[model samples]
Structure formats: C-alpha cells, structure tokens
Target: MATAFKQIEDEAIEMARSVAYSMPIEDIDMTDSARFVDNTHWAFFERLRKEAPVHYCANGRFGPFWSVTRYKDIMAVDTNHAVFSSEAHLGGITAKDQEDDFILPMFIAMDQPKHDVQRKAVSPIVAPANLAVLEVLIRERAQKIFDNLPINEPFDWVDRVSIELTTQMLATLFDFPWEDRRKLTYWSDVTTIDVSAPDAKMTRDEQRAILIECLTYFTGLWNARVNAAPAGDLISMMAHNPSMRDMQPMEYLGNLLLLIVGGNDTTRNSITGGLLFLNENPGEYQKLRDNPALIESMVPEIVRYQTPLAHMRRTALQDTILGGQHIKKGDRVVMWYVSGNRDETEIENADAFIIDRARPRQHLSFGFGIHRCVGNRLAEMQLKIVWEEILKRWPMIEVIEPPVRVKSAFVKGYERMMVRIPG
Candidate 1:
C-alpha cells in the first residue's frame, strides 16, 4: 500500500517536471496557490533556479514581482536591508501585497532602529536560560501527548499532534487562557490563508472580522499586563518595554499576528514533516533506529526538508543589481527560501533527504540576517524533545496516506495526515 502511494506521488512529480520544462519561461508564475496545493511548486522552482535565478513576472496574481530562486542570490537579498526593504507600507514580507486599508506594521516589516528596538523587546523570551527551562516543560508535555495517542487505529497526525502541541506552546508564550488555546492556531491559519483560492474557507471580510476578535481578546490581556508588575510572558514583556508599550492598535495586532504565525506555522509543519519524511525514506528511519543520538542533526534536516514559510518578500528600496538583473526601486522582490534550501550548488544532492549530513544546519529554513526567526532555538528544542519521546515509545508511526497540504504559496504546511501507531 505504501509502495502504491509512493508510485502515484512519483508519477505526479514526473508529470509536473514535464510540464515545467515545456512551459515558456515568461509564463511561469510561482504565486499560484494551486501549484502548492498539488505539491508541484517544486518543479516550477527547480526551473527558476536553473534558468532564471532572478526572473520577473510581469503580471503575477498579487502584482509584478521578481523571484530570487538561488541560495547565494537569496542570501544577498536577505542580508541587504539597506537596498532591499521589508517595510509593511511597501507590502511587507509576502509576495501578496498588504491591503491598503489593512496595513500591519510589525518589526519584521520595519527597517533599521525601529525594527531593532521592537525586536529586542520580545527577544529575551528565547534566551538560553528561557530555552533551558522550556526544554523540561516541552518533554513532559510531549510525553503526555504521546501517551494519549490511540494505538492500532488511524488518526489525523496534524490535528492530534502537530497543531495541538504548537498551539499549546503559543498559549504558554502569550500567557493566554489555557482552555482557549486553539484560538491561536485558528488565528494563525486565518492570517496566512490565500483568500483568492477557490477552496478558501472564508472571504476577506470574514477573515478581518475574526482577526479583529483576536485583537480584541489580546488587547484585554495587554491592558491587564500593562497595569501589573512585569512578568515573563510575551504580553508582559511587550507591555513593560518602552519600545513596544506605546504601539498603536493596528501595530499591536500586526506584531501579535507575526508572533502567533511565526511561533505556530514553522514548528507545527516541521513536526508533521519529520514523521512523513522518515516514513518516506525508510532507510533513514532505520539509520535513526540504529543511532538515536542523530536527533541533534535530524531536527534541522527536517526543518530544511519541510522549508516551512516558503518565501519572504522584500521591496527594493532603491535600484539594485541582483543576479545580474536590474531591480527597480519599489519593485517587489521575493526570496524563495524553499528553492534556496534545495540549491545543488550550495547543498550536495539537495533533493535527497539524507539525515546524517555533516553540516545539517546550513540551510535557509530559519533564514538569515537581522530579520531571521527569533524563536529558532525554541523551535529546535521542541522538535528535539518530540522526537526523543517518540523514539523511547513507538518503534514506528506509519503515515497511511499523503498529507493534505495547506493551500498557500507562502506557508508550506500540512492540513491533515492520516497515521497509525502499531499496538
């Protein structure tokens, strides 16, 4: 049964590769959400990396934009904040432009001093001491989650494991109400949903209404925290810090959404991805079984293989030459971290998921430069703890079917994945 599923997936990939090669270079649009849903975006990105490392799409779904698809090229753009900007007013960190009336000015979207100060306000949450404390809590929770799994029966790994664990962690970080923790997961999903997709769950208006509810609820918590003595939670940190304390309502909402999504998506998706990859590559699974100590390297490899948060967008602050192409000021520049992670020039046999690579951490998943993921160590610790607990208990957790992927070019994640753990 597993072989049959693998064959079907392989054929679909071959068909995608064929179409990718046949299509004209000028017509390829990476922003199409359908490609991501079908998991065919791999071929599109592969073509872009080889032929047009810095290609421009004249009429993208969002707008005209340049695609930076190589590892070195992506690194160059990511590190050069002076010339390439992530300003929210300039459309923020996504290929899709922010709505004119709905601009959310988070730190990641700001440049220079403002971005630094605001980021510093919440940076202590992931300090080494904080992570040391989190590791103990994560392991205990992971054990409880694993102990409750249904034996010898199929269940949705995404719902049962991935979403639940990540959402719980998000709730802890915000010091949110424990019973309403799933709200964080829901808001994270809504924040990244491709509203234009045919299968979209809600319209833009509906999404806005829900997000406003989230802001209202968090605003109450913020107000409460502001009056109390400083605490360790993110809300308390932001409330106490001078740099973040004076933020406007929309700015507050924007940073809230950023922390929620940033904390949720990357870790959640990689947790699910790790299981699926291990199942797909049984040899690597066997290698893991032989040496459980490999978990240190396996975690980052899983992150790289998943490449959650597929791309980050920047606007050209001024005219610049990137990959020999002239980028005009104010033009949208998208660095495809997904493609860059798979660049063969930088990573040998990049397409293959080899668990024990000598340099497992040398990938673009966590990104680079000042705007890199702040909770990266926390993320790694959670993944490491989950796998450690899993190895001590289950010998194997079988992925019974292909994962239903999220319908967004930006967030590469699973919506559902059926799995069974043998009794």
Candidate 2:
C-alpha cells in the first residue's frame, strides 16, 4: 500500500509543480498535501486572499471545493452552521472528501442537537476546574521530561519534548497507562497521516491494524468505566454521560480519534513550532527570555503562527451565497485557517510573530462558532506550562537545521526537529 501511495504522492507533487507554474493561482487545488509539505501553499493562498477570497477550484484532489481564504469570510461560514454543515454523513469536515469506509461520526463532524449533546458530555475534562488540576500534573511531567534530556548533544525535539509532553498530557486526560502512552502518539500520527505522502511509514493495512488496536484498548477502558462510578477522565466522562453511554462502536472509535488527534496535534506542533519560530525571530526569543511572563501572550501567538489544523471543511447544506459567490447544495467549502491567520486585514503585521500583540487571541487557529475546538483552552494551558518550565531550565534549545515538517494539509505539524540544549 505504501508503494502505491508513494506513486500517487509522486504524481501529486508533479501535478502541483506543473499547476503552480502553468495555471492561475485561483484554479490551483491547494488540497494536495504535497504542495503544503514543499511550503508552496503560502504563495498560493496569498494569491487567493488577494484576488479570490471565495475562489472555486473545479478540479481538486478531493473533488471540487471553494476556498475561503479571508478571516472575515471564514468567520461568516463558521458561524453560519445552518447553511454550511460539518456533519460526517454530508462529506464530513475536510477538503479530502470522507470515504464511506472511513467515516467516523465524531461530534466535531456532526451537526446541531447531536453535536451539542455529545460535546457537552466530554466538555468537563477541559473545563476550568479540571484545567487547574491538570496544570500541576502538566508541570510535574514537563519537569521530568526536561530533566531526562541529553545536554550539549543534538536530539530530536519532536520526539523527546513535543510528542512526549503532549502524549503524557493525553494519557493523563484519558487515564491511559503511563508506559503505553507512546501508542497514543503513534495512533494520533497515523490517524492524520496522508498515506500518499512519502513520510507515511506504514502501509494501509498496517495503519488499520494499529487503529483497531487503539479501539480495542479503549473499548476495554470504556467497558471498565461503564461499570464504575463517574470520573474526570475522558473515557469515564463518556461512559457516565447519558448522551455518549450508548455510542456505536465506530462512533466510539470516531470520538476517540477526535480526542486523540485533538489533544495531540495542536500542542505538540506548537511546542515544536515555538522553538522554530524563536530560532527564526531571535528578538522575540530575547523578549520572552527577558520577560518570561510574556509566555501568557506568546502561547496563543504560537498557536496562530503554527495553525496546527490548517483547514476545516464544511459542506453546503443548501444553495447559498458566500462572499458573493453562488454555492450549490453539497458543495464543499473549506475554511483555510492557516491562510486566515495570516490575513493582514484582520491581524496587524500578521506575517510577523509578535508575542505581545494587543489582540493576540483573535486568531482562527481554533475554528469559530459551534464546532470550535473543545480542548483549545487545555492545549493553551499545556503549552503555557511547558514553556514556563522550559524557560526555567534551558536558556536556549537551538534548532540544528530546518525542521522536517509533516506532509499533510489537515495537520500542520512537525515530523522531526533536531535541537541542542547548550550546557
């Protein structure tokens, strides 16, 4: 399967390269992760925002779709959930159209009453009270992780720091076994990896096997939680909550994937991205070092700059007009959060990384309206704690070279980031 995917990826990259030079930017399908992995999507999106904020691509990898590139336009679509649906059955929430076999009915991909009810069930895990408890645990874990790293020697920060810290937090969220937490990171990466990308290590069958293993492990946890009293962990919350207690097997798997990816990607990438961004902008790093308190504002800026989840795809429920363009029922409309975060109109000097921006939180890294990221506050808290602890220990964690980035349009993340902590 990997062999096949490699072939497809090769063709996709060639196609992207060809279209990049030949076709008008608006007509180019930015859905190809290949374009993103190569870092060419930035210019493509810039053109879209300037020329065609509500542009249509008649032929895209995921079939035809409209790209909503501007911040205001994305907000309008995000807030108007009635016209633009996130329901999984109606092509789900991605530019890469959901396949029937791969459908997982998570609340993020659902609509209205069902989405609200199910979301309510697990909202407590990230609620203010829970976050306060998690903060102490997160700091303790960050200390342990930082203490164990090799000093004065180059190591992969993505694996040692970013993935480790997030995976630890994820385990705490689910009450997953400490030793088996790495499996959560594996599953999260596998869940979002584009099989066609060269970086995808597993074959299709292998990926399925791992996911089945994840479901099976969680099913055991769910079964145990169902019989026990209510608890703070995600599984226990779902088990005890009336709305989610009777979820179908696939539905359970779907929610599990959602929670895993949701918990894992955003913070993990931001941790790695914050390092890379600081390396790129030495002045910001110095500002942060001189005034460690800036971490409060810097955390959200990292999320915006990273834009972990690049886009959220919404389906047109009925014929509608968005940004003065006629959108047909069933047409896929993708809100490019990555592009919107950089829109100069909404964010001043949006392209630059300013830690102390007045309105730092006004970014679309977390989608707006009903389907906004449920664990966003939790993610921000984790990043804040990690950075706070990091500043206490190392003065600098220098990137050895350019970080190896993830090859996916959906998850804007890092694969490998080598760094050295100066002794």
Quantify all predictions' global Cα lDDT against the true fold: 0.93, 0.88
CA displacement after TM-score superposition, residue 392 of candidate 1 (Å): 0.2
Residue 266 displacement in candidate 2 (angstroms): 1.2
Residue 73 lDDT in model 1?
98
Q: In model 2, how large is the Cα lDDT of residue 134?
A: 91
Q: Report RMSD for candidate 1.
A: 0.8
- lDDT for model 2, on a 0 to 1 scale? 0.88
Model 2 per-residue lDDT tens digits across residues 7-91? 5545665655555556776567878887667655776777789888999999887789999999999999999998999989888
As a whole number from 0 to 100, the lDDT of residue 392 in candidate 2 is 95
lDDT per residue for candidate 1 within 1-423, as digits (tens), equals 555676778788889999999999888989898888888888889999999999999989898999999999999999999998899988999999888899999998999989999999999999999888888888888888999999999999999999989998999899999999999999999999878767788999999999999999999999999999999999999999999999999999999999999999889999999999998899999999999999999999999999998999999989989989999999999999999999999999999898999999999998899999998899999999999999999879999998899889899999999999999
Against the true structure, what is each candidate's TM-score? 0.99, 0.93
